[model samples]
Target: MAATSLSLQIDARWRAATTPPDRPCGMEDIETASSSVVIVRGKEADGSGFWVTPSIVMTNNHVVDHNPDLKVGKDFPATVLATDSVRDIALLSVPNVYPEPVPLRGIEEMPRLADDLYVIGHPIGRNLTVSKGIVSALTNDDYDDRQYIQTDAAISSGSSGGPVVDRCGRVVGMATQTLRGAENVGYAIAWSQLSSHMDRMLKVVEGSSPEERELTYPSDQTEVVAKYYSTLGAGELAEAYDFYSASRKARLPYESWAQGLGKTVFIRLVSVTPGDKSNSVKVHFYSTEEVNAETWEWRTGEFEGTWTLTREGGLWKMNESNIKDITKPTTSP
Candidate 1:
């Protein structure tokens, strides 16, 4: 939809939503703004982002550090245009992106402590979910002489790069993370700290594409890939769980993921080849598993597939995988 078609009135510049204090939070404006909010998925990134320009989306840097194949919800493909590691913010170029860009307002009237906050996003990547919170505190950051919005909102894994909106659904801040071991203690990059930086990033450079950049693994992935399947076969479930990237973990739950692998008896790595993209690799393997739920008999099958791995905490972790069973019933482990 075009900017003029929007019902909610803003300044001529589309910088801010001018919602009066008396207006209730659950209004038509918010529902309309939800259409602009989109779920983002990449090999290593899974989160939410909002359009800043017609085709430019705003998300967190960690969400798309590597500009690999990215999907916006299920509607459009996207590419990273810029990233700010210090602010944990990223801008994406989504061609023919839908809805309209969220208002990028001045921080003149910044969200104060104890102010109400809300987020409308697909946190678990299922359906649009709503979370209500209050600005607990504004923590100062030495990094950029800016402040962070600390709120008691439900900012989980997939909601990391989502927009934290005000009662009027105006973009107040960007959801970054939840405090570990704390209940509902989420932190966001305050609008006061983001407005200028976001504009600067847009001006500096257009992000590189896979063909333009010679991407490389931080370390050799041979051993890491081998260890992953072998660990699963050994039933070292706890250790195997650590091999998944943050986004992969969010997409899959431990209980369900573990249950699915229960029948695995052994997996032997066969061949590992570099994929077309440096961050990805082609892997071939054979697996031996119990024949069925009622049987102890074992069977083996040959498999070939590709995997996307990312460097997380100095270790290579599986971000995504697409494996195919190429063996017949007579295949061996």
Candidate 2:
């Protein structure tokens, strides 16, 4: 079946608000908060959407998964504020200061299965658009102790990181994944997950002076080791090792270094496990080049590798890497 094409229309009123006056506010004051939504465009991948809070902006981890050059802060060339991948969520601080932060609904206040839900995002690179649907189900299929809010909302590629609102227009979760063979079958990371991870991420980004918080990369010595994998057409491995943490690099050199690899060794990112402030990001990439006329050969195999990263002088660097094999189902000849 042909995929559905969705488009968004840019509304100036929906842009992030710059100034919010101080005073006792009412529902009318909060209703005008639509300006907090912003469009995030990555240089290496398709543009994704995100919404803003007073101190941070939120987006999906997959959106910024491929581009290591992406950064947060006023000097950032891109439109993003900040990102966290472990939760498949990112936060961005607006360039121009805004008064009020976007309000978040408490986990206890979230909706139940089959409840009404709404989503707002820039679908298909158009403009701000709102889609409505119902909460399909609730499941713990993805992560332990964390529940996922399933919805029938029309979430597309560019819709990642957008807000999923409840009946009263309060955000209940962040839009994340979808099923391929289904219609309007989309999933969102519940607010509980966000509440669990937001504090740590905020501390890392806002704890120290802005100058003290910078992404780290591996040293020249590690780069030499990484280049070995890169020579094997493992660009993802090379890049993964470049971002490994010091301790991980020292312990599991090859495995940690190769963990960021994908199936085909292509530089495009398929998935990532964004580690905490002290840990490294586990990235999965796919090779664009085909191995043969029939079957394609992946970088490490079917499964991707895991790499470690550490912070050195405020920048994130690779520590170690290793490759693992993935098994694929056999087809009759």
Candidate 3:
């Protein structure tokens, strides 16, 4: 009798809609973007991946390269272009072009603790499922320099290699694993850790197949935000700084500007809304870290700012002078 009741309860939840019918929280756009995510099947396991470029998909190395039959760059659905096992990020070239490539956030734009985030993946062999959560923490592997984005977003057996995006619908990390005995604790390879290898990720696909001939890069405004932050997170300071307009960069030289970013542990975009003027975005951020060397304790707080981005030569660049801070600081243990 008890087993029967439990079975019925589980059935009811599954029968519930995978997504809300009303499509709240910009869920509609997120669902559409998820079209880029794909199921990666290997000899030993099945995982998920999303397109980074027209024909190139990014996923976990273990998902496609763990078993003997799933060799990178030689597999059928995707060829492995590059792999960083330490970060668990892999780049692959698919035979076809993907229409929607998810936008990735820069490392320097790390999500703040407790900020709402989401993950889309094929958990437990089911089709795509989007699970939501908050940024729980930023953790590091004791053995290496790699950092992990810890969130409560549910990550199941087959969810590896999925994209974890912030409320702004920007990719911040790649789903990797869940804690063994925990319910909501999951980890992803922060995009910052994957940023440095992006050149190789794109380069490996150049001229490799006829699919490249048909590829087209979309200039979505949100994608620009994603790339800008992901570049910063990956520690490509020069590249990220270049996202600022030439005049802005000149006014705030790299050295002085970078120095102003002192000792940040993590930053999360709490909200991103369109600014008053065209091509402007109002960004609300939250960051957490030690306030001073003497305490060495962690604290979280909110930051509000606006950016005026302009399209130059078919690319977006930030107008840094327009940035403003609207922070509400609070300390928590």
Candidate 4:
């Protein structure tokens, strides 16, 4: 059966708050709706996704780009199940997730001019962020000639794949992109525009794939380590800590390891390749590190390192790092 046909309206239970445009939505309703949002991280893209079904997420295709080792919400492994890249839409299988699916508006209920809309996303891959705007002008923002929902709402970087929900908390559209150097000009592809496509995509009957997915040689290995460095450079010590193998964590306490890493402010990944063996990755990077933590003077350096990761509980954790060939740091992205 199709997940969409004639029924796409917000449930009667949610309609109670629809009459008041200025009144805040019920806290329980908004929180549950927001919980459907998730962080999407791939080697090339960072954005947000939302649960369209219990086990399936909808996002912008540019966010995943068919990345094999995509991570959704707190590092949960994800797989690209479908994509219509031209439309900037994609769906992924995210097993063992608990966020509830959100409602979508019917075509008859499409937003009109000045209709209030709220964009919920994780801008810059940060926490849940929401921006408010009205339906500006409905027109083609791309070559597809499809009508896109243009809003003044900030769909800044990292918020690209998030949900654009209505005042009733029903998903009206999917945040797609923003124009550089342009203010408050962001485009979204409405669900009503792709209801048929989504109806089929949302039927996620496949069982969860095994959590311990092996990397496919060079490409996967490089991206895995690169994501680690990306997190490190962002000063996400707690998240980086989880990447360490249990045995490695046993040897190096979090405080000590974080203290050591604190010396560097940022790491710019240059090149990464698979090592001679399947378990290793070689990295060439540049760092802008603090010379003295107190004075905060920084120095740049070029570096090379080999990282060994151990498979544990369906994920790879860092086992060892062999860093050498450290010439003075000049920056390379």
> What tens-digit string does per-residue lDDT give for candidate 3 at 270-310?
44555787787766556665578787777676666667777
TM-scores for the candidates:
0.56, 0.62, 0.50, 0.52
Better of 2 and 3 by TM-score: 2
Model 4 lDDT at residue 130: 80
Q: What are the per-model C-alpha RMSD values against the true structure?
A: 14.8, 10.5, 16.2, 12.5
After superposing candidate 2 on the true structure, give the runs of residues whose Cα lies further than 4 Å from its correct spot. Answer: 1-33, 44-52, 67-82, 98-107, 206-212, 215-238, 244-293, 296-311, 314-316, 320-333
lDDT of 3 at 158: 86
Residues 91-150 of candidate 2 have per-residue lDDT tens digits of: 554433445444433333557777877776767656776788898888774433556799
User: 1-333 in candidate 4: lDDT tens per residue?
Assistant: 122321322254433423433556554444556877889988766899886655667898778753446898876888765554345677776666544444333232568889888899899988998888899978763323455888999898999888887766677788998878889998889766655555543332121124422322111444457667766787777876777889999999998988776577888666666787888988888888888878868888788979997777656667998988578556698
Which parts of model 4 are misplaced by more than 4 Å?
1-28, 98-108, 141-145, 200-333
lDDT of 3 at 140: 83
